[model samples]
Target: MVALAKKKEWSLLLLLAPALLYFLIYHFIPISGMVMAFQDYRIFGKSPFVGFKHFRILFASPAFLQVLRNTLIISFMKIVLFFPLPIIFALMLNEVRSSILRKFIQSTTYLPHFLSWVVIAGIWIAFLSPANGGLNQLREMFKLAPKDYMTDKGAIRWVLFASETWRSLGWDSIIYLAALASISPSLYESADLD
Candidate 1:
């Protein structure tokens, strides 16, 4: 048992060595570089210690503050506001009984999620064009004046949110579906018995 344990420990070390070395070299070494943030970094010789100067500069800059605020707002919109929409979409999709229609909808919707950002930007430009675009065309049919939403600051945020929802609505719903499928059959069976 002692010899077997020794063999297993050696085997585990051999298996882990490459990954351990990579982490130490890539992650730990790079992280250690952050200490330079507090020091006056130079190519040669010992870096002069200048504690909190860079941090003070970072906090005092208005541009940095605006950037920080924008980061917070965008993160909140994407992470918090957008999170529940996919679950609702999945629940709605799961209720539809027609397999062909379900598959068609899923495929068409999922296709957008897989598109590159450049392709998606092109699609959005076409969709939101003021002249003869799909959305404007629909608006004109309803006797509404064509409005360019892409360039409007008031509309751009909602445009971003809507586009994000459109792309992710199908893909993220897949998780909800897996969760739904994981539900025990006995619950339905019991309800039917009652």
Candidate 2:
């Protein structure tokens, strides 16, 4: 069998040709482009090798350091601060007995997940617009100062965090929702009886 396989059987390989071609085209082709990372990749001409130069420059750049810091801050805010929110939302959803209201809430929340990031960004911009945003209007209603969140350094990170959370909220809760659905109703009954 091993000798026959090594002899290149046309039948089995023909059956796998499409999958092999897909791997060659999509996977290996792009990965082989990693050679460009070591070269000054020119579109029309031969790329000259520049080993570790780009990496060194990237690491040394002050702008890169600040970007890294901001990324860490945003990640912490999104992951640590936002982690419990979906679970809490799912728990609240589980407690609600009204099927109509529950479905309504689910639909609204799930709809955001279907929207593109550009649309979400536009909505956030409208919300934070200085002159006539909902937030500014609310502030004015309370006789407080209207701050432009878009221009405010202190508020931009929060805006980013909020937008990310809003985008993922319903989608993330889906797993918990599935888990909640699978829980035996008798468990709740037993707890109530105790």
Candidate 3:
């Protein structure tokens, strides 16, 4: 058995070489640059070690604190408020009897997920534009003033949440739909009988 394993060792190593090389190039090599976080990075000459000096300055800054607060709020909105949407969407989709309508809704929602963030951002910016934007046009029809959502500090977080939901809702609901599909028909039949 040892002789046979030794004979195939070169073949086994050849098969593993691509993955090893990929990790070395992409992951392990890039990790070495993390040392720069503790150093006062200089374009020329050796960089001096600064330890936690940068972190101290960052934490002390009012702007950083505000940014951190905004990040936390956005994260909470995305994680907590957005959590149940996909599940609810999936449940509603599962109950849809018309295959055509279901397919259309799924396709329309899932299309946004395939778009890159840059493209999605552009789409949102255009849609939310205070001048001649679809949303603003609708607002005008209701005798309301056009609001610049992108520049408004108070509205920007909600814009981010809305964009994230639009981008993720359909794709995220797929897992829930799959779970729903996996339930045995007999279980539903038994529940119906009850």
User: Highest lDDT: which candidate?
Assistant: 3
Q: What is the TM-score of each candidate against the true structure?
A: 0.72, 0.82, 0.87
**Can you give the lDDT of residue 190 in candidate 3?**
100
Ranking by TM-score: 3, 2, 1
Model 1 lDDT-worst window of ten: 66-75
Residue 67's lDDT within candidate 3 is 93
TM-score of model 2 relative to the true fold?
0.82
lDDT of 1: 0.88
Candidate 1 local lDDT, 71-157, one digit each (tens)? 787778999999998888788877889989988887887788898878888888899999978999999999999999998867877
Model 3: residues with Cα > 4 Å off, grouped in runs: 7-22, 40-53
Tens-place lDDT digits, model 3, residues 1-194: 99899879978999999999999999999999998989999999999999998889988998997898999999999999999999999999999989999999989998999999999999999999999889999999999999999999999999999999999999999999999999999999999999
Error of 3 at 126 (Å): 0.8
lDDT of 2: 0.92
